[model samples]
Target chain A: MDLTVTGLSVRLGKRAVLHDISATLRPGRVTAILGANGSGKTTLVRALAGLAPGEVRLGSARVDTLDPRERARTIGYLPQDGAVHWDVTVESLVELGRMPHRAPFAGLSAEDHIAISHALAATDTEELAGRLVAELSGGERARVLLARVLAGRPAWLLADEPLASLDPAHQLGLLDRLRALAGEGMGVVIVLHDLIQAARAADDVLLLREGRVVAFAPVAEALSPDNLRAAFGVEVMQVRDEAGRILPVPIGTNR
Target chain B: MKRSTLILGLTALVALLFLGSLMAGKAWVPPSAWFTADPRWWIVAELRLPRAILGLGVGAALGLTGAVLQGFLRNPLADPSVVGVSSCAALGAVGAIVLLSASTPLIIFGSAMLAAAGGMALLAGLAWRSRSAVAFILAGTVLASLAGALTAFVISIAPNPYATAEIIDWIMGSLTDRSFSEVQFAMPFIAMGCVALLFTGRALDALTLGEDAARSLGIRLRRTQMLIVVGAGLAVGASVAVTGVVGFVGLIVPHLLRPLTGARPSALLLPSALGGAALVLAADSLVRLGPGATEIRLGVAMALIGTPFFFALLLRMRRSAWI
Candidate 1:
């Protein structure tokens, strides 16, 4: 499903946090919203997921006409620091993703159960599926979160830094799984800080600064040092081996 | 191993306790009166039976309301009384007696309902302003303290010092001297309150995951907040109206059962209610077993038992730290 945003603005009290921002979520690709802290990356992600209370203009297409629950059925959202009070098992937590798809006071159908099982398996968290969330390590928690987002079987999955706490192996594995989700025609949008990882994971990049879209295009063109410095005030020297790919090279001897 | 059997077992236990409460009262009725006694059978049917049910009813209300408040506010210390619902009920009951000069039961019941509503209104406002649990709870504490001091002040100026002593006991809470009239008067409100609170189960479960998470789940913040307010207020208001201001049942019931139920507000509600009933019934029995006609004030009776229970709960939590 195609999602569109037009002429969006965010004002927190008196300060204008996001300007007249606009973007389209292209299908079968990972779109990265990259920027420094407080650069409106999270806000833009939040807006797309319909969580933020700001002026939003969605298309008049069939998808846009769907009810909020119907929208939730297809649009998976993973908020930053999802709140949890008690220690529920991983399977039960993932099952909550199906709430929008089912009617109230009704148990999950067979298909819903299948989807939950599939999500747990895909995230490679089946081993820890019985564990309580509170008992899991930070990296384990992140994996469980990914499983939860995936369990909804959404057409579009929006995650706010899904890999913010991963070690190298799980990080690469999670990116591959997300790419695979997109390969199945699911649109994935992630808010990311590590530029290198964003370039490696996403098919396209959408850069933001002060809540305004700075770039929305292919990873190769948008990851340019010029745009990076313009948005983040950081200098970068591009590097590459024989593959003709750009590698992020940090400048200044801050190390 | 079987769920139905477990439910049946619990039901049986509650039934036995309920039966004991009816037959064990001061007035005795013969076994023949169990079926054939005329207006005199009212002792069991109208008086002790409803009182026992109220014990269970109020217990459940306090417990479930406590759980919802703590989950909604996300504060471990978020007891219902701390927010002035009970005190407000006391103020209303006091007003009904001293100012309105209403009937004995009406004065006891009406004022409690009014006071509980007042306390809840203030709490609802605080919650709306910040959606922060700790802030709302602290606000509740402030209001509760204010209500408590006001209760003391009102009693000090009471026209009859002898009546003041009785009023003090009522404020502290009691089922003493209660007849069928008190039981009949309180039944409907408590029943309505329990039903109202049950509606909050879904919202509370969603809320357990936190506000941002709940919002993303397509549950409106304002709507959920409203359900919580009305449900909690109704249940608490009805409970305090009938029983004066019993303390800590809400605080302790949910605290004990949270681990078993996995912190989902949906699952916690009924269990907390059941647990609360059991807790209060046990506490009431303890009071009954104690010496003298100056029956230990119900509120004080609960406090004496609840204080140690609260400490034990904390120590248990400390041992099982992660959850």
Candidate 2:
């Protein structure tokens, strides 16, 4: 089922953050939301996840009208700052994702155990499963947080700046995991600051400028020189790598 | 230690302390007194039993509230008193004594409960819109200060010296001379409050990931906040209304049991409740067994113990860079 947004507007306090945004995000595809700072990337993603006020529909059902538990089971969202307050173990942390699936007083079912193990393996956090989250390094913590989201096995995954603290290898590893999830008919949306990673990993790209969509298209068109210059005010020198993939490296500011 | 084992140990300790509390008064009534029809059975039944029950209920309420508040605010220093409900209830009880000149338990209990409900309502009104833990804490601090100042104002203008002494003695807090009526009056509120707090464990566990993630995980922020406020208000209000203001059981028990429970808020709830009961029962029993002619106030004893523990905690937290 496709996630659709129409005439969506958001205001944080008195300032308008997102204005009349409309988009259709399909299942089994990775959509990379690329934008400069303060371009409403987080806001847009949060709105889509029903964390912010917006008119959103999942297939034929209004996403806002869905039960909170059902919405949580369908849409898994990871915020920009992945702050874990307690010093709980990695496995315990991941088990928190299954909260929406389990009853309040009931213990974990066998299905929950399977999903937890799968998430741990996928994020390569199996080794850190027994370790406390407070003791993990920055990159390790980021992976564990991502694993927590994956444990829920939501139909749609929305992550904001998930790659911020990750190393290059882990970033690629995460992109691969996201692709694998998309292959399994799950809709994956990520907010990214790295244009090259977005272009390389994303099936569709949504570019934003000052809370407005500059372009929403396939990678080739969305990251085109003109659109990149318009959205980010940066002129990129397109270089093709050994695999013949276009990598856009910003040369100078268009401003 | 395993969570189950720790809980079992704490529960056993609470049971033991309860038995000890019944026997540790000025007149030591042996366990044989119950079966042998000793004349001192009235002391066991009429005097000590009610006090022990209150100690257990009050301690459990404080401990449970402390764990819930700390988890909800994500601040380890949060306790039943931090939210201002206890102080507001104290003010209500003091007002009943000074203004109405009523020393009756029913009037005092009703006034304190009403004030605590008001405090909870005011807290909700002030912090509801921000929906931030920091905002809630700030609002609580403000209300606490306001209630404290008002309580002082009421005391300064007391109608007589006897009333002032009575007010001072009551504020010192004790479980002494408490009858079964006080126990019956407080148990229902304490039990209800605990039930409400127990339901908050899952939501509190979700909150370990912070507000946005907690909400995304299907935890309703408003509902969780309401539970914490109302639960703590009812429990702490009734406790203060009955026994004046017993301090530190809520704060100390949760902090002590957090490591044993593996630091999960949900896992800490029951252990904290049990631990709190044990700590309070032991303290209450010790105060009764003290050498002084006048027994040490339960509140005073807790402060005497809690201040040093609190200092040690702060020093340790500083060394660990946890502050």
Best by TM-score: 2
For each candidate in turn, the TM-score is 0.91, 0.98
Q: How well is each residue in B1-323 modelled by candidate 2, as lDDT tens digits?
A: 98889888998999999999999988898898874678898899999999999999999999999999999999888898889998999999899999999798899888888888899899989888875789889999999999999999999999999999988999999999999999999999999999999999999999999998998999888888888888988889899989998888888989999888887899999999999899999999999888968899999999999999999988888876345
Q: Which candidate is the best by lDDT?
A: 2
Model 1 residue A142 distance off true place after TM-score fit, in angstroms: 0.8
Residue A42 displacement (Å), model 2:
1.1
User: Which residue pairs show backbone clashes in model 1?
Assistant: A83-B209, B88-B115, B89-B115, B89-B116, B92-B111, B93-B111
Q: What is candidate 2's CA lDDT for residue B235? A: 88
The residue-level lDDT of candidate 2 at B150 comes to: 93
| Model 2 CA lDDT for position A115 | 97
DockQ of all candidates, in order?
Answer: 0.54, 0.75
Error of 1 at B189 (Å): 2.3
Single out the weakest 10-residue window by summed lDDT for candidate 2 chain B: B314-323
